[model samples]
Target: MECKNDYLCEKQINMDKLFEYSNRLIKETDTKFFRYMYDEINWKNRMIGLIGPRGVGKTTLVLQYIKQNLNPSETLYVTAEDFYFVDNRFTDLADTFVKYGGKYLFIDEIHYPNLNKIQTFPYNSLINSYSLSCQF
Candidate 1:
């Protein structure tokens, strides 16, 4: 996808060749769930919050939607538990990512306490975090 800031953006490298092979069963099952949610969601201009007990497949549902609808290059999947996140600032990563054309960010385990303080990061990037947390 083309971005306004060419200097900040670079070509996306699809390192995971696995994305090419369409898994019929996974797609079908994910689609069924997406369809159900689609019927329930008004995606036009609303934020969606998916909450449930652990291991109930909430993350699976988000990943499935991103896989089916968006190019992998335009998205970034991150988890608060990631080692890199321990010492890294979410705002810094988000600024670098968005300034480079990132569109969707799928963050898991965001209920972590570290992220709670990130809502006060002095940057536009924290807006998404706050919005997302509020939605949650």
Candidate 2:
């Protein structure tokens, strides 16, 4: 199932444009670091938690994986800090992503205050590949 073009807009991001940004980001981030995460990640029935200090490029690594391995239509990349999230529930967004055939979900800032509430329910209830990370 392909994601509707409007879904990106609803997220306040242009999917095509974000893909282009991702391409450029691929060249900018450390290839070695991304390769390490790629090799380490189980990618099947696994939850990954990346904990590191700020500016250590954890978010970049996640974006690099999405940019390299999956089509934008098949993924949803979101940061908890985004204002849209104030009104939109994380579960709702996950549900939408699953309905539109999203396979991989990359969520940044998992250590944020309300994250525990979001993680209380089983992510498999919405989609698979529920990979999360935070800057510690």
What is candidate 2's lDDT per residue for 64-120, written digit by digit as tens? 776666666666667666554677766665665565566666676654544444555
For all predicted structures, in order, the TM-scores are 0.56, 0.60
lDDT of 1 by residue, 1-136 (tens): 3544643243222212212222322344455455355446443332444555677666666667665666565566666565556655556556555655666655566654344345544322332231231111
lDDT of 2: 0.56
**Any residue pairs clashing in model 1, and if so which?**
none
Best by lDDT: 2
Scored by Cα lDDT, where does model 1 land? 0.47
Model 1, stretches more than 4 Å misplaced? 1-35, 44-47, 113-118, 121-136
Candidate 2's displacement at residue 78, Å, is 0.9
Top candidate when judged by TM-score against the true structure:
2
